[model samples]
Target chain A: EAGVAQSPRYKIIEKRQSVAFWCNPISGHATLYWYQQILGQGPKLLIQFQNNGVVDDSQLPKDRFSAERLKGVDSTLKIQPAKLEDSAVYLCASSLGSRGGSPQPQHFGDGTRLSIL
Target chain B: AQSVAQPEDQVNVAEGNPLTVKCTYSVSGNPYLFWYVQYPNRGLQFLLKYITGDNLVKGSYGFEAEFNKSQTSFHLKKPSALVSDSALYFCAVRDGATGGFKTIFGAGTRPFVKA
Candidate 1:
């Protein structure tokens, strides 16, 4: 089976610029997630989607970050007026279904490395 | 407020020797613990998880993790370390405190399996 796919594997932008990263989740997957990983740290959840609706985005910096999973298949994460702190790896993941009773593992993409100068 | 901790920033093991990476977590409900490995420049790959029942859960690439509820720990272990096992390992737990399924990861632990 094909894994989660992400494009623009690398991006560089000046401060206050805007950038967007795209992701294509695995087929039949109903849950998609976006995460940010900084150097020396583990990945942190930025947002999560269940189909075409958002399930969680409490941690996302709404002032600069936004994401949408249209048609419940592909997602795009956008960061406006990028800050130096936003320089990190943006990862996308997908799971079989909901985050319900049984636990499931998430399939991940290679991720997009963003650099803010 | 669910969170995980990887006590060792790095672990060094000789090939063919047993290797262990320590992990501890803090949660408000029944914990759902996971272990993932990431190679250089790659995204994270799931290794194993402990949601209930089994104390020792085996995963891919000869990896296993023991879930100790009493100790609030889920330490990753490999019986015979291989040079290829060298990579970054992460410990994660679901944010049960908020009654949501958001996952929180720890500062990764780098494993160096010397050949």
Candidate 2:
């Protein structure tokens, strides 16, 4: 089976600029996640979606970050007025697990590395 | 709040020797622990997970992790490491107590396997 897909392997923008990243999860996956990983750090969960509905976004920075998983197949994460701190790798992952069910291992896509100037 | 810790910033081991990477986690309930590996400029790949049943769980690429409830640790181990095993390893945890399945990841540990 094909793995999760993400576009624009790299991106660079000036501070206060806007940027967007796209992701297509593995087929038949019910759960999709977006994460941000800084240099020398582990990936941090930014948002999670179950099917077409959001499951969690507690850690997301609403002021600049917003994401949507419409139809539950693909997802898009947008950063408006990007800050220098937003420079990091944005990752997308999918899993077969659902809420209240046994957890499954996640498949990931080669993330988009963003640099803010 | 659920959290994960990778105490070592890096670990070095010689080829054909055993290697261990330490991980510890804190969660509200029975924790779901996971191990993942990442190469340069690549996404994280799942290695293994410990949910229930066994304390010792085997994962991909000849890797295994032991879950110790008392110490709240899930350490990754490989017998007779290969130079190909060198990469950044991450420890993650998801709190089973909550209905939401938000995962928390640790600050990764880079392992160098010298040949």
Considering every candidate listed, which one attains the maximal TM-score? 2
Per-residue lDDT of model 1, residues A1-117, tens digit only: 999999999999999999999999999999999999999999989999999999889989999999998788999999998999999999999998545676688889999999999
For model 1, report DockQ. 0.85
Using lDDT as the measure, the top candidate is: 2
Report the lDDT tens digits of candidate 2 across residue range B5-108: 99999999999999999999999899999999999999999999999999999999999999999999999999989999889999999898986588889999
Q: Over 4 Å off in model 1, which ranges? A: A98-100, B95-98
TM-score of each: 0.96, 0.97
Which pairs clash (backbone N, Cα, C closer than 3 Å) in model 1? none
Tell me the spans in candidate 2 whose CA falls farther than 4 Å from its real position: none
List of chain A TM-scores, every candidate: 0.96, 0.96
DockQ (0 to 1) for model 2? 0.89
lDDT of 2 at A38: 91
TM-score of chain A for candidate 1?
Answer: 0.96
Clashing residue pairs for model 2: none
lDDT by residue (tens digit), candidate 2, A24-44: 999999999999999988898
Given candidate 1, what's the lDDT at residue A109? 99
Q: How much is the lDDT of residue A13 in candidate 1?
A: 99
